[model samples]
Target: MAEMTQITPFVNCRDLAAQRRFFEDMLGFTCGFQADNYAFLRRDNVAVRLLEVDFNLDDPARQQMVYIDVDDVDALWAELEPALSKLPEGRARAPFNQPYNQREFHVSDEGACLFLFGQGIEPSA
Candidate 1:
Protein backbone atom coordinates (compact mmCIF):
# COMPACT_ATOMS: atom_id res chain seq x y z
CA MET A 1 0.00 0.00 0.00
CA ALA A 2 1.11 3.53 -0.73
CA GLU A 3 0.18 6.84 0.85
CA MET A 4 -1.03 9.58 -1.43
CA THR A 5 0.03 13.21 -1.38
CA GLN A 6 -2.51 15.71 -2.62
CA ILE A 7 -2.54 16.82 -6.22
CA THR A 8 -3.16 20.54 -6.88
CA PRO A 9 -4.64 22.36 -9.87
CA PHE A 10 -2.69 24.58 -12.23
CA VAL A 11 -4.60 27.20 -14.22
CA ASN A 12 -3.30 28.90 -17.34
CA CYS A 13 -3.72 32.64 -16.97
CA ARG A 14 -3.17 35.54 -19.34
CA ASP A 15 -1.08 37.56 -16.89
CA LEU A 16 1.13 35.91 -14.30
CA ALA A 17 1.60 38.91 -12.02
CA ALA A 18 -2.10 39.82 -11.90
CA GLN A 19 -3.05 36.24 -11.15
CA ARG A 20 -0.49 36.20 -8.35
CA ARG A 21 -2.13 39.26 -6.87
CA PHE A 22 -5.64 37.77 -7.08
CA PHE A 23 -4.58 34.58 -5.35
CA GLU A 24 -2.69 36.50 -2.70
CA ASP A 25 -5.38 39.08 -2.04
CA MET A 26 -8.39 36.80 -1.93
CA LEU A 27 -6.96 33.45 -0.85
CA GLY A 28 -3.95 34.62 1.15
CA PHE A 29 -1.54 32.60 -1.01
CA THR A 30 1.98 33.96 -0.93
CA CYS A 31 4.47 33.56 -3.74
CA GLY A 32 6.11 30.19 -3.53
CA PHE A 33 8.10 30.47 -6.75
CA GLN A 34 8.38 32.82 -9.71
CA ALA A 35 10.64 34.36 -12.35
CA ASP A 36 9.03 36.04 -15.41
CA ASN A 37 6.06 34.29 -16.97
CA TYR A 38 5.07 31.84 -14.28
CA ALA A 39 4.69 31.48 -10.51
CA PHE A 40 3.52 29.22 -7.70
CA LEU A 41 1.42 30.23 -4.68
CA ARG A 42 0.36 28.61 -1.45
CA ARG A 43 -2.11 29.99 1.09
CA ASP A 44 -3.95 28.39 3.93
CA ASN A 45 -4.11 24.82 2.58
CA VAL A 46 -4.58 25.65 -1.10
CA ALA A 47 -1.76 25.36 -3.60
CA VAL A 48 -2.10 26.76 -7.13
CA ARG A 49 0.16 27.30 -10.08
CA LEU A 50 -0.34 30.24 -12.41
CA LEU A 51 0.84 29.89 -15.99
CA GLU A 52 1.03 32.81 -18.39
CA VAL A 53 -0.63 32.51 -21.80
CA ASP A 54 -2.93 34.41 -24.20
CA PHE A 55 -5.68 31.87 -24.58
CA ASN A 56 -8.31 34.51 -23.91
CA LEU A 57 -9.37 37.74 -25.51
CA ASP A 58 -13.14 38.25 -25.40
CA ASP A 59 -13.03 36.63 -22.00
CA PRO A 60 -10.46 34.35 -20.43
CA ALA A 61 -10.43 30.91 -21.96
CA ARG A 62 -10.27 29.45 -18.53
CA GLN A 63 -9.27 25.85 -18.89
CA GLN A 64 -9.33 25.05 -15.19
CA MET A 65 -11.75 25.83 -12.36
CA VAL A 66 -10.18 24.84 -9.05
CA TYR A 67 -12.37 24.17 -6.03
CA ILE A 68 -11.00 24.07 -2.49
CA ASP A 69 -12.55 23.17 0.84
CA VAL A 70 -12.58 25.67 3.66
CA ASP A 71 -13.91 25.99 7.19
CA ASP A 72 -15.70 29.33 6.82
CA VAL A 73 -17.61 30.33 3.72
CA ASP A 74 -19.26 33.60 4.77
CA ALA A 75 -16.08 35.17 6.02
CA LEU A 76 -14.29 34.61 2.74
CA TRP A 77 -17.30 35.81 0.75
CA ALA A 78 -17.25 39.02 2.73
CA GLU A 79 -13.61 39.53 1.85
CA LEU A 80 -14.28 39.00 -1.86
CA GLU A 81 -17.70 40.66 -2.15
CA PRO A 82 -16.72 44.08 -3.43
CA ALA A 83 -14.42 42.86 -6.18
CA LEU A 84 -16.61 39.97 -7.28
CA SER A 85 -19.51 42.33 -7.90
CA LYS A 86 -17.52 44.51 -10.28
CA LEU A 87 -16.84 41.96 -13.05
CA PRO A 88 -17.12 43.46 -16.54
CA GLU A 89 -19.48 40.84 -17.96
CA GLY A 90 -20.02 37.23 -19.06
CA ARG A 91 -18.11 35.93 -16.06
CA ALA A 92 -19.89 33.35 -13.94
CA ARG A 93 -19.99 34.90 -10.48
CA ALA A 94 -21.98 34.27 -7.33
CA PRO A 95 -21.82 33.33 -3.64
CA PHE A 96 -24.24 30.60 -2.75
CA ASN A 97 -24.98 28.33 0.19
CA GLN A 98 -27.65 25.86 -0.57
CA PRO A 99 -29.06 23.06 1.49
CA TYR A 100 -26.37 20.80 0.15
CA ASN A 101 -23.29 23.05 0.08
CA GLN A 102 -21.63 26.37 0.75
CA ARG A 103 -19.33 28.35 -1.60
CA GLU A 104 -17.57 31.64 -2.28
CA PHE A 105 -16.69 32.90 -5.74
CA HIS A 106 -14.09 34.76 -7.83
CA VAL A 107 -12.41 35.06 -11.21
CA SER A 108 -8.86 34.01 -11.97
CA ASP A 109 -6.42 36.86 -12.56
CA GLU A 110 -6.60 36.45 -16.31
CA GLY A 111 -10.35 36.81 -15.88
CA ALA A 112 -10.23 33.09 -16.53
CA CYS A 113 -13.25 31.56 -14.85
CA LEU A 114 -12.58 30.26 -11.30
CA PHE A 115 -14.38 29.85 -7.98
CA LEU A 116 -14.10 28.36 -4.50
CA PHE A 117 -16.00 25.49 -2.94
CA GLY A 118 -15.82 26.40 0.70
CA GLN A 119 -18.03 23.67 2.07
CA GLY A 120 -19.87 20.60 0.86
CA ILE A 121 -22.40 18.05 1.96
CA GLU A 122 -20.54 15.09 3.34
CA PRO A 123 -21.07 12.28 5.79
CA SER A 124 -19.33 12.37 9.10
CA ALA A 125 -16.94 9.64 10.13
Candidate 2:
Protein backbone atom coordinates (compact mmCIF):
# COMPACT_ATOMS: atom_id res chain seq x y z
CA MET A 1 0.00 0.00 0.00
CA ALA A 2 1.16 3.52 -0.69
CA GLU A 3 0.97 6.30 1.86
CA MET A 4 -0.66 9.55 0.89
CA THR A 5 1.67 12.48 1.61
CA GLN A 6 -0.08 15.69 0.67
CA ILE A 7 -2.86 17.28 -1.32
CA THR A 8 -2.97 20.65 -3.07
CA PRO A 9 -6.25 22.31 -3.97
CA PHE A 10 -6.93 24.22 -7.16
CA VAL A 11 -8.81 27.49 -6.69
CA ASN A 12 -10.40 29.22 -9.65
CA CYS A 13 -10.39 32.99 -9.68
CA ARG A 14 -11.10 35.72 -12.19
CA ASP A 15 -7.90 37.61 -11.28
CA LEU A 16 -4.81 35.58 -10.54
CA ALA A 17 -2.76 38.56 -9.41
CA ALA A 18 -5.35 39.65 -6.86
CA GLN A 19 -5.69 36.10 -5.55
CA ARG A 20 -1.90 35.86 -5.31
CA ARG A 21 -1.79 39.00 -3.22
CA PHE A 22 -4.57 37.71 -0.97
CA PHE A 23 -2.69 34.47 -0.36
CA GLU A 24 0.72 36.08 0.01
CA ASP A 25 0.00 39.32 1.83
CA MET A 26 -3.05 38.27 3.84
CA LEU A 27 -2.56 34.56 4.41
CA GLY A 28 1.24 34.61 4.66
CA PHE A 29 1.81 32.19 1.80
CA THR A 30 4.82 32.43 -0.50
CA CYS A 31 4.70 31.88 -4.21
CA GLY A 32 6.81 28.90 -5.13
CA PHE A 33 5.99 29.09 -8.81
CA GLN A 34 4.01 31.34 -11.11
CA ALA A 35 3.07 31.44 -14.79
CA ASP A 36 0.73 33.37 -17.05
CA ASN A 37 -2.51 32.05 -15.62
CA TYR A 38 -1.52 29.99 -12.62
CA ALA A 39 0.49 30.17 -9.38
CA PHE A 40 1.58 27.73 -6.68
CA LEU A 41 1.46 29.11 -3.18
CA ARG A 42 2.59 27.50 0.03
CA ARG A 43 2.79 28.34 3.68
CA ASP A 44 4.48 25.68 5.77
CA ASN A 45 3.04 22.33 4.66
CA VAL A 46 -0.25 23.66 3.28
CA ALA A 47 -0.40 24.59 -0.40
CA VAL A 48 -2.95 26.01 -2.83
CA ARG A 49 -2.88 26.47 -6.59
CA LEU A 50 -4.56 29.55 -8.01
CA LEU A 51 -5.80 29.36 -11.60
CA GLU A 52 -7.21 32.18 -13.66
CA VAL A 53 -10.63 31.39 -15.06
CA ASP A 54 -13.62 32.92 -16.80
CA PHE A 55 -16.68 31.83 -14.91
CA ASN A 56 -19.86 33.23 -13.45
CA LEU A 57 -19.42 34.25 -9.80
CA ASP A 58 -23.18 33.87 -9.36
CA ASP A 59 -22.98 30.24 -10.36
CA PRO A 60 -23.40 27.91 -7.42
CA ALA A 61 -20.82 25.58 -8.95
CA ARG A 62 -18.11 28.22 -8.71
CA GLN A 63 -18.22 28.49 -4.94
CA GLN A 64 -15.41 26.81 -3.01
CA MET A 65 -14.63 26.29 0.66
CA VAL A 66 -11.17 25.43 1.99
CA TYR A 67 -10.47 24.47 5.57
CA ILE A 68 -6.94 24.78 7.01
CA ASP A 69 -5.83 23.10 10.22
CA VAL A 70 -3.48 25.28 12.20
CA ASP A 71 -1.48 24.91 15.39
CA ASP A 72 -2.99 27.94 17.04
CA VAL A 73 -6.09 29.58 15.63
CA ASP A 74 -5.99 32.55 17.99
CA ALA A 75 -2.37 33.32 17.25
CA LEU A 76 -2.86 33.08 13.54
CA TRP A 77 -5.94 35.28 13.76
CA ALA A 78 -4.02 37.89 15.76
CA GLU A 79 -1.31 38.09 13.13
CA LEU A 80 -3.74 38.25 10.22
CA GLU A 81 -6.38 40.50 11.79
CA PRO A 82 -4.83 43.78 10.69
CA ALA A 83 -4.53 42.85 7.05
CA LEU A 84 -7.92 41.13 7.02
CA SER A 85 -9.58 44.15 8.55
CA LYS A 86 -8.55 46.17 5.54
CA LEU A 87 -10.59 44.01 3.25
CA PRO A 88 -14.15 44.89 2.24
CA GLU A 89 -17.01 44.12 4.59
CA GLY A 90 -17.80 40.41 5.00
CA ARG A 91 -14.42 39.35 3.63
CA ALA A 92 -13.05 38.43 7.06
CA ARG A 93 -14.33 37.20 10.42
CA ALA A 94 -12.84 37.02 13.87
CA PRO A 95 -11.95 33.79 15.60
CA PHE A 96 -14.77 31.90 17.25
CA ASN A 97 -15.32 28.60 18.98
CA GLN A 98 -17.16 25.93 17.09
CA PRO A 99 -19.42 23.18 18.35
CA TYR A 100 -17.08 20.62 16.82
CA ASN A 101 -14.34 21.33 19.34
CA GLN A 102 -12.37 23.77 17.22
CA ARG A 103 -11.62 27.46 17.18
CA GLU A 104 -11.79 28.95 13.73
CA PHE A 105 -11.24 32.15 11.78
CA HIS A 106 -12.83 32.76 8.43
CA VAL A 107 -11.75 34.78 5.42
CA SER A 108 -12.36 34.93 1.72
CA ASP A 109 -10.36 36.08 -1.27
CA GLU A 110 -11.43 38.25 -4.18
CA GLY A 111 -12.65 35.13 -5.96
CA ALA A 112 -15.12 34.34 -3.16
CA CYS A 113 -13.36 31.20 -2.02
CA LEU A 114 -13.98 30.78 1.69
CA PHE A 115 -10.91 29.83 3.72
CA LEU A 116 -11.34 28.59 7.26
CA PHE A 117 -8.40 28.30 9.65
CA GLY A 118 -9.08 26.14 12.67
CA GLN A 119 -7.35 24.55 15.65
CA GLY A 120 -8.62 21.76 17.81
CA ILE A 121 -9.72 22.59 21.33
CA GLU A 122 -11.15 20.85 24.36
CA PRO A 123 -14.86 20.36 24.23
CA SER A 124 -16.99 22.62 26.29
CA ALA A 125 -18.43 21.37 29.52
The residue-by-residue lDDT of candidate 1 on 1-125, one tens digit each, is 99976666777777787778877765567998998878988877678777787666345344556777767766676766666555457453566655554555545445554655566645333
Candidate 1 vs. true structure, TM-score: 0.71
Top candidate, metric TM-score:
2
All models: lDDT?
A: 0.66, 0.92
Clash number for every model? Answer: 0, 0
lDDT of 1 at 69: 75
Model 1: lDDT to the true structure: 0.66
Best by lDDT: 2
Lowest lDDT sum, 10 consecutive residues, model 1, at 101-110
lDDT of 2 by residue, 24-100 (tens): 99989999999999999999999999999887865878899999999999989999998898999999999999999
Return the TM-score for each candidate structure: 0.71, 0.96
Which segments of candidate 2 are over 4 A away from where they belong? none
